[model samples]
Target: MNDSLDHDITAFLDTWTLDPNQTKSCFLDLKAHLDGLDGVRCEFVSRPGITYSLRAAHANQKKRGLFAMVDVIDDDPADRWLSVCFYNELVDDPKDMGDEVPGGLLGEDAKCFDMYESDDALLAYIKERLGAACHSASCE
Candidate 1:
């Protein structure tokens, strides 16, 4: 993992009041994997929700870049949850990740899911999807 990115992630997690062990372990794990890949930059957006997005250029420069994945944290604590949106252009069923999928997602390409447990299978699945998204691309 890149040091700056690692620091940024830790800082973000620190800002949240939610239990890091309970709600953020999966995301932190995912972030660790993403950090090892090249050109897979992370973008943090604070709006209606705090969203950390992973992005990469597609195989064809003319084509749209892939909005690989995003982890969102809502404003309300009780309503707070981590949501991962995997781009469907390169993934079949992002919502049906190896683990259970969370509710509140509706879109062809915006398939969302939430991870509450540490599942190696799920991480491997995500890595596969990421490879597809970066196929022949400069992602890295």
Candidate 2:
């Protein structure tokens, strides 16, 4: 991440009130995983009162700009949650833990996992999907 992006992300996190369940940690952990990827770049988008999204993509991807989006849903800013989305073709939902959104991802079909509370098991599963998506995107 560049200085500007790092600053922006820090600002977003700073203002976000942590929920009692510690759901914010889930986003932090996922962001750290993305930052560790070999050739990944992430852009942070803030749509205040709607969402604060981290859009991540592999360096080699040509068709789409992003492979996954980690969003902090801000409908209820005081009680925020997460909705991580990925292109359907890039990741497999073997455990059926995500929702099938017909056109949720930039007009393409997407598989999204919603998190309202901190859960190590679910976070681990999502991390696996992120890795899978990064690999698939890199191949493109």
Please report the candidate that would top TM-score against the real structure: 2
Q: How far is 44's C-alpha from truth in model 2 (Å)?
A: 0.1
Predictions in order: lDDT: 0.54, 0.95
Each prediction's RMSD over C-alphas, in Å, is 5.0, 0.7
Tell me each candidate's TM-score: 0.61, 0.98
* lDDT tens digits, residue span 1-140, model 1: 45775676667677766654355666666666665666555654445465554444343434444445556465554345556664444446554663333332233345555654455676567666655555534433
Which candidate number maximizes lDDT? 2
For candidate 1, the per-residue lDDT at 110 reads 54
